[model samples]
Target: MATQTSIPASHDRDFYAWALESANRLRAGNLAGLDLQRIAEEIEGMGRAEKHALASHLKILILHLLKWRYQPTLRSLSWQLSIANARDEIAELLEDSPSLTGKLPEILARRYPAARQGAILETGLPAATFPTGCPLTVEQLLDPEYWT
Candidate 1:
């Protein structure tokens, strides 16, 4: 059997405080939990263009957070700063890549079909007609060539 050590209550409280602060920032930016829920509904209703936009934003945010928090080598404050900087660089690449911009929604839809459907419906956008030009696909995003 595995034993678990209890974390101090103060540590839990501090963690909650930091999480709340982050949530507040997201809310102030119109990206609250409720807003995200609404966006999920909108995804089902959205036209292809709107769905694509939302998907792109979501991906960028996820990638940014991953880069910021999960870099294997960044254990110290300075390395963490480097992670943040790398996230920014990744953001820039996403913004500038036309191929990626087009396929964002398809990637999301394939990756999270239910959530994508809900978002389209909530956004009140018409059904999407995925264009042929988009470079990102459900498969491609999952197994990215660039990353490989």
Candidate 2:
């Protein structure tokens, strides 16, 4: 049982304690004491955070791939490791949330410009060197062996 005074007091002072307290309350059938509003929002935020993480990893992976393709002479182990790591992370994310697969095409299209600009800064290549649109499809981007 949670200390009576610790219930509300711990919530504002220490988040971990608050979470533990909340779990205790929930498991003990003390729904009346839960901060359901905050818990609901946090749960919602978790989904959005996963989506954002997927998009971010894809962006970096695509950027490095553009650099790899456009600046072949400048390629190094770092880029190879980045692409491989990103692919692994993306695969793990998809394995956990297969539903997000449908969103990949949109995410790739939306994030391509950022990837292109990132490539420009890293490669010092003219912006015009990269196509105005993404050159690779989501399938191509995710393929481990597809290095152009």
Q: In TM-score terms, which candidate is top?
A: 2
Write one digit per residue (lDDT tens) for candidate 1, span 84-104: 454454355565554665665
Give model 2's TM-score versus the native structure: 0.88
- The whole-model C-alpha lDDT of candidate 1 against the native structure comes to 0.44
Worst 10 residues of 2 by lDDT: 2-11
Quantify all predictions' global Cα lDDT against the true fold.
Answer: 0.44, 0.89
lDDT of 2 by residue, 12-115 (tens): 68878777778778889999957899878867887888889899999999999999999999999999999999999998998998888899999999999999
Q: Pick the candidate with the highest lDDT.
A: 2
Per-prediction TM-score to the true structure, in the order listed: 0.22, 0.88
Question: What stretches of model 2 exceed 4 Å from their correct place?
Answer: 1-5, 9-12
